[model samples]
Target chain A: MGGSTDSGSQNRLGRRLLTERVSGYWLQGAGYFAIVLFALIVLALLYQSLPLLSEYSLVQMLTSSNWDPAQNQFGFLPAIVGTVYVTALTMIMGTPIAILAAIYIAEYAEGRTKTLVSSFIDVLAAIPSVIFGLVALIVVVPFVGDYLAPAVGSSATGLGIFTVSLVMAIVVTPFMISLSVESLEALPDELRESSLGVGATKWETIRIVLLRAAGPGIFSAVLLGFGRVFGATIVPAMLIGGQTHLPSSPFATGQTLPTLIVNDFGELMSLPLTQSALIFVGLMLIVVVWLFNFSAMILRQRLQQRWQF
Target chain B: MDRYTEQRLFGLLARGAAALVVAVMVLVISVTIYRGGRVFLMDPTIVITPPGSRYMLEGDGGFLHAVLGSIFIVGPATIISAVLAVSTAIYLQSDYSSERFSDTVNMFLNVLWGTPPIVYGVFVLTVIIAIGARTSMFFGIVAIAIFQYPIMTRYTDEALRSAPDSVKEATYGLGATRFETALMTARAALPGVIAGIVMGFARGIGDAATVLFTAGRSTNMPAGPFDGATTLPVLIFDQAMSFNAEVRSHAYAASFILIIAVLGLILVSKLLAGRYARYAPGGRHS
Candidate 1:
């Protein structure tokens, strides 16, 4: 505002224009950095993982449960199932409470209670996943092994699919709750007003009107939470008990793909085939998360377009 | 089975769920603080003291190395990311770009944001292997910067998008260029930008998986950015997994410091964004 206007000469104005043009181009480059980084991640994983694909087909890697690194057995069926099992459990336990809490915040909570619960969720989000892992390792594992598992009449050490998913349920609830609160709050007040005016009760209006309107946003929130739990590493790594075999039950130990990479990549980096396999594991994770993220983004955009007045 | 009773029951359930979440969070924080506080209660200066030989085995020293290491790695990484993220957010505005372009790019950024931190670590480690370098603090910085970049950019972009169009129009009316307009808009969105930056710093400092392989662990103090370093989160992972009872307590103490730093940042972020919302256009005067 000051420089070019304050200057007296045509030369200074020309220089200012040049600088502005250059800065524009610079900002454009900055804008493209995300695209570039995304492409680089995909390309890097693809390049590293091409070899394993050549050696064994995708279905084979996905279907076979054997994972003997020493014997060149690189099946991922168990890990893939384990990942799904953990994610399903996380969602089942987390989504109900998250949606209910979100509904409470949007429909029922007074000012102070809403503010307190939202801040609590914010605090939970700020706590790192590794901290969750550490706490689960110390508290949940022993509780399951020493008490809960015994109560269920199962001999379990507690480091299993169930324990990891339980901890993951807690870890991912903040994300789902925050996003869900946004979706529910974004609905027009008239939507609620009309429902109540038509003689619908509060719960009935929320169930029949608001929740239906906010369905896309809530579903997308669930999808993003799925991605979060799907890609979870620390909790699974610390508490999965490092079992390579397929688990016989929820109480049995197993690893997710991310945990598989984390637990094995350090020692196996020197083995070319093993390194490729681990990178392939990473590729699978990226692919799955990308799919979830893509659909969630679409759902989010739909919700935005619908609500935009 | 009655309608009113059903409504009351659900309302109670929802309240219970909300209270349950709050209680779990309180319990986790209190347990860590209490357990971690015991060690620090015995030796209050351990936060500042460096570790010694057999630190993991005997818990002979403090976690100063990891504390310093986290600062050194995540501090500069966050600076780099803040610059890039702010500029990227500026460029994505309607003034400087098309709506379609912004939307598409935002989708990409969203996906990148959702990409796991471990993926970023693997990406950086792959780059390191391709370039023939060992794991070090420098690579750790690169990994975390990439991980934080999308997150910060998304927050800043949202902030800038919510900035009043009147401010931009005023700048243009005054003969300011697009870049100058963006600079002014950024100033108006300072609260959200600062909050995003603080959140990024907390994440980068707290993530262990991103730097697990990229930053090799070392007991001695990191000599330089290229040297191996163990961040507080990574140190906690190691100590928590250590078979020794003393080392496990060290995990608690280290987490105590890490939790305090992270939760304090979260609070600062919330307070800044909430208290300063009126600074923008159409809001109360300062």
Candidate 2:
């Protein structure tokens, strides 16, 4: 460190350094801000949810499987089940198409075709989920009921696990495609060249080498997409056919945590227990999202470490 | 002959699939436009005339107001978010390291980037409403900023990290201070950062759930931070659920407008990214 001789100069230098250290304190304050914001959110949710938890113990809330807000029987098992069911279904519905689209865009398609497809994906990403809900409610539900349901063995009820998953797939597909394309783009040119040089077909090289190398990244994308579909409120709110108790059938009406909060909170504002019950649901959702994030980070670390090729 | 046959078959399959994806996307746009355009075109009742005239009357101003409200809400939020995000990124990158601090920052940003916006909306709404900041556009803007910051942070980090290390070292080796190098050397490479900020704006505008809770549902133009106002998403939500047929048409129109603005931003970013990738060999594209 540079040294100063005069005591006054030393004090001036010390103050200057102190000021510099404190400069843009807001930047360092951001971590504190994030933690506080998250804590406040959790606490507020707990306050809101206290009513329902007090009215019914946590055990009953977990085991009852019935959601009768009016009757004061607030079992969330069905909603939890439904939320997970739709998320998994959406992943199943969307992943293959996303992977294929990413492969086509990043690996195979060239020129105007690539640009056009890429633009389409971007547009899809830009379109809001509520718009998707409107479209699904108006067009998709009818189409599903009139054609898809009869073709299969189920009838379209306008709200069901299937419709929710379908809408969720549309929302999630672009995310998955975008992420996979990123990882695909990250692959070095030489890896592709060497695979080609070894007399391997393009499909073989993509499946065996590219896909394997991109595994962790692709997994991260899927998990990210899952996080999105899990938290989405409008689609499930608008289209999920059954709204009363937990949905027993795929076609049965159901409520996820967000919809439950919106639905019950409006009427139960005066009831602390009711409000707290819903907040408890929100807390559950935060936990689910946190879990998804933790796994995705792990997967991302693995991908960054393993995929130097 | 074999190679030609192989090319022909694979080429046909590829062309077919490409055509399908294109067709599906076009169908989505065309449908949205058709639904949206009905507000301007087919509805004779929607035509506005002078109040005293016998000719006609104006369509309800719901869609118009909604569009304006969205702009008002997202615009300031985007600016504030961009400043904070870029500053933070620059501060971090000015002392580039594979250290714990940088990693912590990256993880926080990544989680923010990946967490659903709906969650943020609910979270912010919980705080704002709890603190009696409800019914204020100020809270709404803050909510949007929260959502936008994560994206900007990631983008700025990537952009600065990708800025040629040689230029930075050259500046530093000449005895230039860190701030000077960042401002003179790094700030010049801010086009990519700016593009990222625009992209964040696009996301903020398209967001419905977040703004819905933070920004209260008011029909009037926002008077100030304290004034209650409804944004495009909230207006659309109200219309979509409304029993009125006329309002439904307006909702469609508003959705179309929001979608166009968002898609436009994304396309611009893509173009900027592609151009940067071609020209700036050292910079990474989002």
Candidate 3:
């Protein structure tokens, strides 16, 4: 058997060597192609955006709050303010609900309830933002205007920072909940069981046991949700009436960075600097999200090192 | 407190809180229904119904052009992105070495992955429009494809890495070339690749920012890749913002379609991911 296998192995080795050479060549080629393609996209975008430096001073663009295109003066300061406010409000409103929902799903819910809830969250994750905005415009706006707006000291129109933020919160909640759920589920069952053995209630076990174990992961999810809300355009565009200035209050009118870019990019066609200024805002958003992702990666690595089943 | 009483309190609180989440789903459906369910049920004028005597379509309630534009943008982007991603993944998962190179590549991919679609849109549009890439559906397609490719590549790379080396060894022993082994032995991994692509496509289709700048608003039917087009998401944005009641109703109808389409893509991808995981080695959970 050993003698026969030697001959067979020799023939197989020959073919394997040939395949190895071909695969190695092709694989590297493919990887390089992807890299080049990605580089091209970045280069293209940067090339177009770089032209803005010739016309506008960075300070005037960033510091000036006025965005009146008719006067040819463009400032993104108010848009930035509105963007941060709405995103901050979304995080504040959505984070707790998401954490609680995640706790319920990971620790307490069982049987069909778990399946149903998980699938529901999955479906929610899939819904388009345009749809979210449309529904919010017709239904949420009217309801808020009729019921909550008066109480919140706003007019009966559905347009306001609070409305946009609320919709954004809803849009991002599923992402937070899903990530938190998965991280919580990844924790050791023994941890929960041991905590329970110590006579802790389920709620206490969740607070002390699950939260501690999944804290980093939950935080990462919230950061991701922040990015999602920050980049979202349609939700603020339609729901908040796409005001280019900062809202007077949380319940007042507002616009976000992406919405403003979308709303005004067309009008600033002749002013390449204004458009590039918008691109710079987008770049800042990318930078913020990149930082979040970097930290999320670091947190994930730490969690992997610290946790085990 | 007794065990039974304690269990009851926790369960009650859990159920009560969970009910609120259920309320959100209900709110989504009910609000959609309240706004446009009547039109769908009563008039049943989906956008694609044949045209009438005039140039006006018979059941022109939905933004059919936008829907078509979405499909148009998503379809090619999905194909190209999937191919790029899977190919890159295969390359990364190969016996290639050097830990530093791997880490560098991962850092680039992750940062690119985290970059939002809107930012990509703004950046890409500025680049393309400045270079005089005509404002058309093609630019939207390309912009979305560029944005989606990195994500697909990462997920596909992970899936390929998870593919059992033993299987590849077995294929190699059978005298299969690397490409053959990748194509044949790694064929089992295609489902996850498809899932990643579909997930990306779902995101691309729903995206509003990238297209808003690149794909200018055009109410007319798209002539070709270069033809200016308004996607469903953009049209929904337009109609939602419009003062016209008829257009607003049309926007609701379009939103209903987009919602259903996105949900369908997600569900199908989930199903595919499950099926892929079953036969796959180590079972990719992503």
Candidate 4:
């Protein structure tokens, strides 16, 4: 009986509810806009890359090592090779050091030391990649040019694939250490204590038990590091010496995908074929990074499942 | 080797590697300070000059213009990203979106997070050029907003997801609408959201690639958002690459400023995140 007298209040409540519903949908649409933007990025890169197909076959572009903008020859072999070589060298140098440090922090360090080491690593992670480039340009290049290249019997400038790899190693190490530390810390206490109970040394426990159990997680971390190294632009742009030739040695100057794009993009904009070829390099970078990230995600999910079990 | 000997060797190696990491960090910071310290000790004028000065080999130059330019570009980019990221996070956490759709969106965001900033520069550059727009601060902001979006969204999403379910249920039990519930949840996670925004801003401000092509380099200060300007990172890159010693010294000075700003923001964001954790239900005690 009282409800009939409150019809105006009921209408107001209904209007309020309707407004909330509309706002909810609008927010959802805004959320979806991020995904839409991602799709647009991929699509735009693909569209820009399409013009290269008419001039050069995909195989030719990927296999041939020529990349002269003036001659209109746009082979991406050297850049691709250079990227792989630099990333591989970075992984080789960075992975072992990072994993070892992560193990020490997660398994060996005590309270105060643990906090100090972890915070230091976090600070290292937060340092911008460009600063690493600056340091490499000033310090690493001279050291390599004056010392390392001479010892290696190479007549090469310091700004080459080796310096780029060293810079990438520094940049990617913190990421690797952080991820590996998380994985190592996630191991059960019982697993470690039991190993110690068996009269196993601490190193034995870590090597025979912890590392085996945390292998996938560590691998995922390595993959993430690899992905990071592959996508790095500024360091390579500054240190790789801007040569678009097949990298013959660690000391030889070369160009990576990112460095090539950054170095030639301004000039390439005037040439359609070369510009499309550069865009194609961008697409290749996306694909390579996607593969690394997807694998890392899959491995991480597997590790989680194993932990749950 | 005996077990004890092997363990000793292994432990030494591991400890040595850990120490090596610390040494590397010290080396990087010390080198930066040593080189970047010259501008302060020898040429204080380089960093203190007014805007609109020429940063040339024979001119009295400073990084005021680029420093101001970085601030102008990053401030709006961070605000735009924070709004979009928070809204998106709220939507995903609410019942307005399905789990499947949310998962897909998150996957896309992850990929976007991994996509290189240069690719973003290329994409935004192409679009801007197609629209007949010149390289300016506006394009820089847009590109950086896109670059920071995934990072902020991920952080905000994690914050929203970690919101205590009991709190959400209580709000709904009081007859609150979904939007109201989401807003309340976001409010409760404000520290984490702010931390995310701060981190994203730090990242956006420090990045050189995203603005390399979009924000055309100019020595003069940016007059407005539509005007062209140079940022600290880009200026560092350009000046370092030049064949002049004076220009290279200026680049070091700019790098010093950029590093200080970035590292400071990162420290602040970390502190904010720690504060957020303390407020979170079941979080570890400080």
Best by DockQ: 1
Ranking by TM-score: 1, 4, 3, 2
List of clashing residue pairs for candidate 1? none
Candidate 2 lDDT, B1-286, residue by residue in tens: 5654664555455455445555656666677777877665654333222112211122344344456667778898999888778767776764633467777667666666766666676676657646756556877788888888888878777877777777777777986555556654445456677677877888788777777666776665567777776677776676777666766676676677767777778767767666655434355454
**Cα lDDT over the full model 2:** 0.70
Best by lDDT: 1
Model 3 CA deviation exceeding 4 Å by range: A1-26, A29-57, A295-309, B1-14, B33-37, B41-46, B49-62, B161-165, B173-175, B270-286
Off by over 4 Å in 4: A1-19, A299-309, B48-54, B57-59, B271-286
DockQ-sorted candidate list, best first: 1, 4, 3, 2
> Between prediction 1 and prediction 2, which has the larger lDDT?
1
Predicted candidate 1 versus true structure: per-residue lDDT over B1-286, tens digit per residue: 9878888999998898888888888888888899888876878777788888888788887888899999999999999999999999999998888999998899899898888888998899889888989899999999999999998999899888777788899999998888888888987887878888998898888898899989887777888988998899999999988988988888888888889999888878777777776767666222
Question: Which 10 successive residues of model 4 chain B have the least lDDT summed?
Answer: B50-59
Best by TM-score: 1
- DockQ of each model vs. true complex: 0.78, 0.32, 0.48, 0.65
Provide TM-scores for the models: 0.95, 0.86, 0.87, 0.93
Which residue pairs show collisions in model 4?
A: none
Between prediction 1 and prediction 4, the one with superior DockQ is 1
lDDT of 1 by residue, A230-300 (tens): 98888899998888778888888998898898878766667888988988888888998888887776777
**Model 2 residue B235 lDDT score:** 69
After superposing candidate 2, which stretches have Cα over 4 Å from the reference? A1-24, A31-36, A43-55, A300-309, B1-20, B42-61, B94-98, B267-286
Alpha-carbon local distance difference test for all models: 0.87, 0.70, 0.75, 0.84
TM-score, B chain alone, candidates in order = 0.95, 0.80, 0.83, 0.90
Put the candidates in lDDT order, highest first.
1, 4, 3, 2
